[model samples]
Target: MTTAQIIYEQYKVLPKRIRQELKLLINSEDEAEKPFSLMEDIEQGLNEVKLIRKGKLPRRTFADLKREMNDAK
Candidate 1:
């Protein structure tokens, strides 16, 4: 397997709460083009899978997130 697969295997064993922390990161990626970057997004995506193995927190809606994000700018 590849590095991603290896990491995924590891992620599959996390508990239920620590995994939810990644929600903060995932929820931050709804914009058309996020400020961080594509590479950063990809890295975050991997982190998302990691969180999922533990337990997926509810995903925020795009509209609410977009509205909140725009308001911040």
Candidate 2:
């Protein structure tokens, strides 16, 4: 079998969440070559804001974010 065929066979057996993550990874590779879109970013930010307002996601402070970034480094 070809490399892609082998990958597909393995991909088929993955759980739904993992398959979704893999799809995102694959799409991100393609996106690397594309120009940045401010509208797309605005839409994503709006969606996150909606989720946060609904209490589906926790709100985070800039200090907490900066701390996490510093810790990562």
Q: What are the per-residue Cα lDDT tens digits for candidate 1 across 20-70?
A: 765555676655345787999899988887886677854557898899999
The local distance difference test score of model 1 is 0.75
In candidate 2, stretches whose alpha carbon ends up further than 4 angstroms from where it belongs are 1-35
What is the number of backbone collisions in each predicted candidate, taken in the order shown?
A: 0, 0
lDDT of 2 at 53: 100
Alpha carbon lDDT of residue 19, candidate 2?
100
Can you list the residue pairs that collide in candidate 2?
none
**C-alpha lDDT (0 to 100) for residue 68 of candidate 2:** 93
lDDT of each: 0.75, 0.95
What is model 2's C-alpha RMSD? 10.9
TM-score of each: 0.34, 0.52
